[model samples]
Target: MNSPMFTRTSQQESAIQTNKVLRNTYALLSMTLLWSALVAGVSMAMNLPRPNIIIMLVGFYGLLFLTEKNRNNSMGLVFTFLFTGFLGYTTGPLIGAYVSADMGDLVVTALGGTALSFLAASAYALTTKRDLSMLGGLMLSLFVVLVVGMVASIFFQSPVLSLALSSLFIVFSTMAILMTTQGIIRGGETNYISATITLYVSIYNLFISLLSILGIMNDD
Candidate 1:
C-alpha cells in the first residue's frame, strides 16, 4: 500500500507526482554541481592539501549528520547547501588533477554523460511500474564489495580487476538512482528535500567515478 503522504488519486497521477519528484531532484542536482564546481576552483586556487581535504569531508559530513538529525528545524536547506559546498571543496583533489588543459574536455564529457545516464535511469524507474526494492539490498552489498575490492586492489594491481570494478561501479550508481526514485514512488522517502539532496550527492559521486573510469580507459 502506498503511504498516504505520497499517494494520489490514481496510478497515472501517482506516476506524474513521482516524475515531479525526479524533476525536482534533477534541478537540485544541477545547482549542487554548480556549487561544487565553484568550491573546487577555490580549493585548487588555495592549494588545499590532502589532510585539509579530508578534514573538510569529515567536518562536512559531521555537520550534515547533525543538521539532518535536526531536520525539523528551519535551517535544513541551509545546512544541506553548506554541506554540499564543503563536499565540493573536498572534491577539489579529484578535479584539481584535471586543472590542466589536457583532461578538461574528457572531464566535461564524462560528467555530461554520467548526468544524462543517471537522469535516464531515474526516469525509467519513475515511469515504469517495476518494483526496485530489491535494489536496496544490492546497494548495501555493493558497498561491502566496493570496500573489499579497494583493499584487494592494493595488492593485486591488476587492470582486469579495475576494469571489472569500473563496470560494477556504473551498475551500482545507476541502481542508486533507480532505488531512490522508486523510494519516492513507494512513499519510502518521506522528506522530498532530503530525498532530492541524497539522490543529488549519489549522482555527483557517480559522475566523479565515471570520469575516473573514462580518464583511465583513455590512458589520459
Candidate 2:
C-alpha cells in the first residue's frame, strides 16, 4: 500500500514526464518540418523530376520502417529526418508543376488551409483533453478505403475520382491530427520520436491533399 505522500509524488512525476515528452515531440516536429521545407524548396528550385511510383513507394515504406524500428533512440531521430526529407523531395515536383502552370496562389492557399486545419484540430484536442481512442478503429477503416480508392484511380485514370480521393485524404489527415494530439495529452503516447513522425506524416498528407484539391478546382 502506498502512502498518500508517495501517491502524490508519483502523480507529479508522471505529469512531469508526460509534459517532457510533449515538449520534445513538438520541438523535434518543428525542426523536422523546417528541414523538410528547405529540402522541398531546393528540389523545386532545381526542377527535380519526381521519383517513379515504385521508387516512391519503396522509399516511403522503407524509411518509415527504419524509423519505427529505431524510435526509442537517437537513430530514430536521424531516420525521422531522412523520411520527412524524402517526402518533401517527392512533393517538390507537384509543387513545381503548379507553379509552372501559374497556380502558385493555389499552393499558397493550400498551405494556409493545412495550417489552419492543424491548429483547429490540435487546439480542440488539447483544450478538451478528451480521449480519442475511439477514433482509432474508424481511422483505420477510412485508411483502407482511401488506399482502395487510390489504387482504383491509378487503374481507372479518372480525374474526377482522383479529386475525390484528395478530398477524402484531407478529411483523414484532419482526424489523424486530432486523434494523435489527444493521444499525447492523455499519456497514451510516450515516445516523442514516434509521435513526431506520426504528426509529421499527417501534416504532410494534409498539405498534399489540399494542394491537389486546390489545383483541380483552379484548373476547373
lDDT of 1 by residue, 50-138 (tens): 45635755776787786577555657767777778777777776676775546877778877988799879877987889889888898
RMSD to true structure for each model, in Å: 4.4, 1.1
lDDT of 2 at 96: 91
Candidate 2: the clashing residue pairs are: none
Tens digit of per-residue lDDT, candidate 2, span 1-220: 9999999999999899889988999999999999999999999999999999999999999999999999988899889999999998998888899889888888899899989998998899899845778888988999999999988987898768979898888888888888878888888889999889889998998899888877677763
Best by TM-score: 2
Q: Assess the local accuracy of residue 84 in candidate 2 as a C-alpha lDDT between 0 and 100.
A: 93
Model 1 CA deviation exceeding 4 Å by range: 1-27, 45-47, 50-57, 153-163
The regions of model 2 sitting more than 4 angstroms off are none
TM-score of each: 0.78, 0.97
| Backbone-clash count (model 1) | 0
- Report lDDT (Cα) of residue 166, candidate 1: 72
